[model samples]
Target: MVLVSAVRDYISRMLQDISGMKVLILDSHTVSIVSVAYSQSELLQKEVFLVELVDSISKSRESMSHLKAVYFLAPTSENIQYLRRHLVAPRFGEYHLFFSNILKDTQIHILADSDEHEVVQQLQEFYADFVASDPYHFTLNMPSNHIYMLPAVVDHSNLQRFSDRVVDGIAAVFLALKRRPVIRYQRTSDIAKRIAQETAVSTVVYSK
Candidate 1:
């Protein structure tokens, strides 16, 4: 239950410090990360009254200052844009931003710049990027499935992007466990080697 426990612990840490009724906001990717490990009843027990996607949350104009917003999303540009728009005209009284993986300094600056109202209570990287499907396995649910079959030289940028995501997911799992692992990959697959190397680099970056 390593992956499940890690995700559950991360969620618990995010919610436990913030008291009172809260609305849990998640992006499309994070929704899968959370749903597999946590249940509605469990969230209700933790005082989470609402669960909405970041994009969908902006559609509602009604204000609910009574509830705090707990956002768990990926550090993607689209997600950042949605947050910027939400921060411009916030409906909730307080916002607690938590990225599922490491966030860049520029992304932090974007969020800080957008929060003119001073509604953000905290910003943190929780590193639950993968969906913990079972005790022994997890998935990134990467969209570029076809890229894995193609040679790395065919489309270097897309291949790099794909490798980076795989690395991030691996890094997140290790970060959750608080351990540095010696990565190994199948020698037959170039993609696996690339992912492993990138994961090693990520591990080094996170270690520092």
Candidate 2:
């Protein structure tokens, strides 16, 4: 399936299922995922008035009991922690949680414990972890993606852990902002040469 359409459809289905004013919550990655396929105006049409980051939402204690909270977050520990905090306090009238990928049993248990108010109406998994830039283009949306080019395997491993992400059947994209390394350094590293090769491969493949 085309990445853009798949993600867009998933989001549309998620919003349409519930009726009322909604506060759309997202994580760092899902921000790119939704923003790429959906616009601010589009969300407004779907009754989404507020778009907040999981990390940032913890700062405010204001109650929004009038709005329904529709959380579209990645299944990560940090994001889960933020959700837990929100659940305990019970700001919104109702909570509809949707994860971008599979949620672990432990994660669910943690949420179950935090939801003392019983505000969470539904929980679901909609697997669209990567951002869909266009019908033909998509990305992992990793900010520190350049770490993949480090000489040691540990650097790549750490970045993977930070993002709680993995990749397969993919290349070149593992190394984003390819030109950064070339322009930043006067001398080419081993990985720098590999970047050139990937660029050549991409050009050749697209030309066909």
Candidate 3:
């Protein structure tokens, strides 16, 4: 099976176990992730009637405790903040969190810390971190394209962000295949080398 298919299977398993009407809540990045692989029609088939961004969903005070919320989002700080706010005043009957990649212990602690209402039911890593634009190829879809041309000293944090996303994409590819790969990056390309190293390091850590 392909990377996209693996992620699809993980999602299918996540939703199939939960019976009844569901609302698929996604973060800004995951909208494309779920939309491309799982269409609106397909989601409807699975009884998912609503698709809303996490931030926007939190803004509306309208309570819809009738529907179960399945959250597929990156384990980003902003998403965590949004989850914290929602736990205080939950609109859905239950919440199932599926992070695209490995979540930090601090992140899990934050979610647990915020979940005083005990609305969150599950937390898992589904490994659909990259946007699958086509069957053979995928893109990290990093927002800042200009980072590669600049030196690391110019913007250390942005460079880290760019590298982290690329590494995440590469890790998702291998995790989907369920295989350990020996990946190489262009030596001349600083960004590629850094990303490759980070990917290898993260893969080792995760696999262990």
Choose the strongest candidate by lDDT.
Answer: 1
Alpha-carbon RMSD, candidate 2: 8.6
Clashing pairs in 3: none
TM-score of each predicted structure versus truth: 0.93, 0.75, 0.93
Residue 147: error of model 1 in Å? 3.7
lDDT of 2 by residue, 1-208 (tens): 4666777888998899889999998888788889988999999999999999888888989899999999998888998899898998988999999987667899999999999999999998765777766776777766766766666645555744633353311222223212222223225566555445544554344233
lDDT per residue as tens, model 1, 27-140: 989999999989999999999999999999888989999999999999998999999999999999999999999888999999999999999999999879999999889888
Q: Return whichever of 1 and 2 wins on lDDT.
A: 1
Each prediction's whole-model lDDT (CA):
0.90, 0.74, 0.82
Query: Lowest-lDDT window of 10 residues in candidate 1?
Result: 144-153
Q: Cα deviation of 31 in candidate 1 (Å)?
A: 0.7
Q: Which ten residues in a row have the lowest lDDT in candidate 3?
A: 146-155
Question: How far out, in Å, is residue 160 in model 1?
Answer: 2.1
The TM-score obtained by model 1 is 0.93
The candidate maximizing TM-score is 1
Task: Provide the global lDDT of candidate 1 against the true structure.
Answer: 0.90
Rank the models by TM-score, top first. 1, 3, 2
